[model samples]
Target: MTFQNIFFNSQAAVVVFFVLSGFVLSPSFFNKSINVRELAGFYVRRFFRIVPLLAVVTALSFFYVKSAFSTWKVPFANSWFDGVLAHDVPLSASILVKCFVGMNSALVPQNWTIACELLVALILPFLVKACTGRLWLAVLTFIIATALSFIAADGGGKSLPVVYAVDFVVGILTFRILQSHDKRYSDVFFYAAVIGLVGARNMLEVLTGQVDLPFNDPLLSLVEAIFAAVIIYGLATKNHMSRLLSVRWLVWLGDISFGIYLVHFLVIVIVARLMTSFLLPYSLPTQTFLMLIPVLAVSLAAAYFAFRFIEIPFNDLGKSLQRRVRTALSRG
Candidate 1:
């Protein structure tokens, strides 16, 4: 299939994820006025949710991924974080410190989004305050995110916190929209998903006319974010696709999605290597399809293990603590 023909999300998946984060978080985080303990609990859960697994993944990358893959030369300019989020320096302690603190550019390049996500989390309450019932604020956030997309392409945009903050705020807006209306789906909503899928699939090719896309184009990002929002919103609501999304297997996938996202790249590398080494298919698509199946399975399996072991335990602990805290507060 042509790149345009392929119905994959590519980079926009991250955008969708950020939107989903906002949508999922808005009701819970902003439904009522914020309180200190509530904010504290949010932070506690958010911290445990993101940091611990990230630290483990970073350590693995530093020790295993880096050491095992000689070809994995360090990415550009994540040089040193001695005292700044961005700077220049030697490589010796850079990866360790950068990856540990969730700074962008590391063994797992995808952590770029994680860095952005964490930054958004830091000011999420303020964002919630600004955006709740304020359509203008949400639109402003989207505009800012799009503007940053331009800066991103020019350079240093991806590392900037504002870019992802827009995405998370977009997510919050999605939740508000859902809450605004009943969680019902119209055929128009299905059409929305189709448009989103098409937009996501062919976005770069269509927008850039087969030319390279600038890193951060505000307009392009907004268009893509719209697609992402439609697709995610469709799945979340009771729409034509609701049954498919509601399937137990898919739900399970969603649960372990974090682990899969974190580990899937590594799995892909391993699986692709194994496929090329053994199968050596002639067709690129054939090779991709063959490896993709196993890569997904392996990634899912690894994620499941991690979810059950690392993520769930801590998540459950955080939830339990929050519950107790809530119970105590209610009594008081």
Candidate 2:
């Protein structure tokens, strides 16, 4: 894929993720103190929202490639299994143990982010409680975490945890801005975010050796900060931009976006492999584009179905569990 297409399709989607996350989590952030019962309920809901659908996708992947299973090897070998069990079914049981402990080696690669998101949710209550609506401190923590991630990057996986953390914190910050009803700052941030994204693309190109640059690291950092700030601002404001984001369709996409993101990669990879197997004569980019069409259609359809059947039911179960626990604790 061309750099521009990749940037807009993937990187920009990540920015949208940050903004949507902020919008979703703003309420909890503004509460200042996390109600433990509520926090538990929220996490339970989130878990059900994600895991079942992921499990289904993982299973599908395994079945699709079951014949190839025996050929798989160590380290990156399970990448072939396609099914959730085989995905987690490591070359050995010791690997399986590690997977259970959140060192997940899954059939679906995108699941790494889900694991990170779950980790964030587990600690969110404490984070919200500690920050106590302090936006600056939350932002600072994100900056430090991101910086550490850059320093420790092992082909970008090391940075992902920090990036997700920043995304969650951006959500919290959005919550704070909304609670405070800070319009002016939101307006400024909105425009600044747009500018930052444009600049970041140029800087990323330089870092990737697609372009020349001086002082790339510091410039990239500034761009990221601006992008993050804009996301927070967009979610926080009541301006026209915010209203656009709140549009029903966009909001719906935002709601299921997590599922879409998780499932899309697998869909694409599977379809691409199938195309290659069938000896499709199309160029790589053309085939990639064609593959994406069905991938998007199928992934979205599956995600919606998953949201209705799997995510909703499990979420309700979590809430039910939380209520029962709360009642028992209250009596104690």
Candidate 3:
């Protein structure tokens, strides 16, 4: 793969995340005995798990945008990074509401993925039933999602939740389909799939060369989702790659990954601005390295604190509330 292809495909990571979400959450919905109360509890747990940290981070992001300059001219600047942090939307009641829902917020752009996750969570139980219970229904659901995605993209709503529901379904299917395969595959097969997934978009662009065929992007996304599912299977089945990933620090980072995603950009902007004096003389690479040291440190530290204090508490509270509701329902 080329340099840009290799390094610029972070969207691949997001695809993997969506598939992994489907696989992880499938177990609960895959339960044939999942009742209404239990499903409600799933929503409750998800809300607590996702929203508290998101809400806090969103608030911080809003205030940062409110107080900070419209454009921060940092040394060794990345256009993408600078552009993401540059915003001057006057904070009003409507803007706050939009930010809360992850609309029109440059500072917290990644929240759109979280919003999609929540949107898909609502229909996931039905999808589980469709996949597990009826092939025709599953196919129909996929078609609808694909059609909606096309309409959404064509109409300029690029990051709408509609675009990702199909990816989540791919994950659910991966979980269901892989349940039968208890056999191990060669590590070569796993690594090859990983490379393909990571570079899928770049390869597609090179091959297509401005050919805007209808449904092309959606089809490519499906291919990438399948690739991600294969990678997930390799890891879940404890392959060599999975073993390498199981190291203690890596696992801890995975635990706090959500917080890291939410707060890293904000941390980067603040840290970059603070270190501008030291960064002025260095080249881009050297400046990036210098910036990475403290950005990595502060982001990890901040994420850890947020995970420990905000995430765990809200998650536990959700569980506690869910238990109380179940108990009260049982008595009634």
Candidate 4:
């Protein structure tokens, strides 16, 4: 309803990624004809795509964590900012293993999503098999997943992969719908979906009169994923907004978006420290505002480099290995 509301749902944006992941990765499994070798190749590509950058980022975060324990200091009075760097986590093998597996680390807190993604990726092929067997089964799968998510939350296991499994199911169902029916929605409908996506949580709050619902609530996440599905539908069907999104620069940014996600936290911490020393004369608000420019610049530059040197190379290696798998299977 308002301009600020359009940006209020950052958690919904993560849900959008989940839905998009389901959509993008669905085509391979939905044919209902994939063999083990093909599935193996699929797993290989996904593993290579996600893990290499994550490994590098985790290693970098470990260095930052060491520094934070020894020498890092908050320049300002923000509690959340201070808590992330100055903390009581010990340097232990268990924590390091957890970080590698997508548990939260102060340096790369976003890795949990990657862990969820990896889990979904492994089970997705089976999900495709189960959900596509019948129409009612697909709906039942979603219902059960939602129920389980709530159950998980009640048991204080909100971060478990089951909590987000429904989001991926929404995506898989989106693909099924698109495959079965082809309709071109009007521009108004596409724009409406965008509005629904960005304002999902706010709209839910208005409807329920429950402000500040828990962030990982399954019911709220389902609404966000459904809205995301509509937006993905609009784009996949090539609506007017899809044209805007397909601009060359925007496409290039999408290519490096993963890298940006991995490196931005590191940039933020480094810049915050430098800003404390150099811009100490300014108010905290002004320092934060001034910090954005360099953060954006350095993050973009670092992401681009990582994409060029790290991601692309690894992706190609995955593809090459996939080809070999296919070739070997054919011979056997």
Candidate 5:
């Protein structure tokens, strides 16, 4: 595999996540003052949306090290917190507390993103409230955050909260723009985002020897978030740029994306163990290719089950609660 192929990019996708979040939650911010019960219910549903799978994954982590990964000898390159694929995972009390609090990357590792999502979500309503009618406020906030994105922070599993929140802000801005502007301006942002992802990369490569900044810096993360925001705008506006995103298969994949994101690591570990037990003689590439099939299949299946049984019920409950609360308020 090529270096870029082997390289896992958590940054580029993060921007997409934040911008999508802003677009998704944008509608909720439309009401000038969200009712207390509805707001509470919204938070509750959001909690269920992410935390249930995260809890399951965190529980599995303890078992993961001892069972599936015990025989896989390779360790994480940088830190012990990354957790050795073997049974050497750090499972301290504080880390466990952090897991519930949405701050535990040491235990679940990829869950740092979960923490960021939660943080952004919790604060999003406030941003929306403060800036709904005040366009200048939103612009000022985005501008300030954009400047801060350059100041380097950990580009690893646990990124800085503020830096990550920049993407969240971008998403919020995209939503605000789309919501307010009926003109074709949403198309402009969408094209800007597409250019940021595709054209900018090529342009930079032409100028510089090799594309260096995309991999190394959170600065690039800020730029990528613009792409995410615009794409979200396009999709929301029903612009031509986002036509491909509405395809049934792709939309299905997006539905279970969170669960897939949370569970894929464990799935990879299990497949690695199976490969080790039965196919020790196979080369790395052969084993890797074999791992992909089971990993994708298993992750998709697990995500569907999680969505059906755990996510949907709780989400429905939240919606029901909000309706009841609103009805009672209206009657009074």
Candidate 6:
């Protein structure tokens, strides 16, 4: 795909994720006291939501990319396999171990964000506490995150992870504003978000010489913060749009979005390989459409099973572990 094509399509879903993250994480921001047990449980749930699909995808990529069975007629060619697993760093044994520990390796390219999400989960409570439900503090947090992101970007590193944390912080701010229940204030933020999003692409293009600025542009952070605040406000208020977003199916998708995000890239790679090998007559768009049906079906099915069996069970286990640790510490 052309750079513009990829930028326009891929970034749309990412922007939605930023908005949804704020909407979902808002509840934690308003609580008077942070519950370590509850926080631990939440993180455990998130971990289970992401890790299983990640492991499967990574394993598949490793086997394919490393040419482990090259003598045999594998489903995909070696070049195809390498393309699927391409990353800045190689997928070596050490990297594979890191992948198991939630660090992304070449085996699953999109998993870089999973690492960031895990880090955000760890510090969310502290961030909420530090902001103290103040708008200025929220703004300050965003500024610091933006500065760090820019520094990282200028240093020739990916700063998307740092930039993404601004979304989480904005999520906390959204919760605070929701709890305040000030209609006028909420309206202002909502409008601001809409305006910012509408102009963000253009602004970033002007500032960074790219249609989509990955992390360097400060305006992109502003856009994220506004987008997050708008989603949070919508979730908190009763409105037509909020009702649409809250529809059972969409909410269900939102619930499983973590799994969807983690698994979708692997699905795409597999589908691409299949199409190439089979000489599928379907055009790219048609193939993409056809591919998504099964991908969504299988991914959602997997997510539902994981949510029911692994995610829920592991969450309870984490809670139990946290309780036991806390009790032991108290006794000591």
Candidate with best TM-score: 4
TM-score of each: 0.79, 0.73, 0.90, 0.91, 0.81, 0.75
Greater lDDT among 3 and 5 belongs to 3
Query: Each candidate's lDDT (Cα)?
Result: 0.66, 0.58, 0.78, 0.80, 0.67, 0.61
What tens-digit string does per-residue lDDT give for candidate 5 at 192-276? Answer: 6675664444444556666555553555666677767666666776787557778998888887887788777777766666656
Lowest summed lDDT window (length 10), candidate 5? 75-84
> Candidate 4 clashing pairs?
none
Error of 2 at 124 (Å): 1.8
Compute the lDDT of residue 213 as modeled in candidate 3: 31
C-alpha lDDT of candidate 6 relative to the true structure: 0.61
- Greater lDDT among 1 and 6 belongs to 1
Q: Candidate 3 vs candidate 6: which has greater TM-score?
A: 3
Instruction: Estimate, for each residue in 210-268, the C-alpha lDDT of model 4 and write its tens digit.
Output: 87767777778888898888888888888888999999999999999999988887778
Cα misplacement distance, residue 119 of candidate 2 (Å)? 1.7
Sorted on TM-score, best first, the list reads 4, 3, 5, 1, 6, 2
**How well does model 1 score by local distance difference test?**
0.66
In candidate 4, where is summed lDDT lowest over 10 consecutive residues? 82-91
The best-first sequence of candidates by lDDT reads 4, 3, 5, 1, 6, 2
Report the Cα lDDT for residue 217, model 2. Answer: 39
Please, what are the lDDT tens digits per residue for candidate 2 over residues 1-332? Answer: 34554355455455445445545655654554466556666666666666766677665655544546423432221344334333233435554343333345455666565666667677766655544445577767657756654554444554455555655555565555555666545466677677666566565875687653322233354356447666556655566677778889888886676578667766655555555544356565676577767788888887787777777787788778777766765666
Candidate 4 regions with alpha-carbon error over 4 angstroms: 1-8, 68-70, 85-88, 104-107, 155-159, 326-332
lDDT of 3: 0.78
Candidate 6 C-alpha error for residue 55, in Å: 3.8
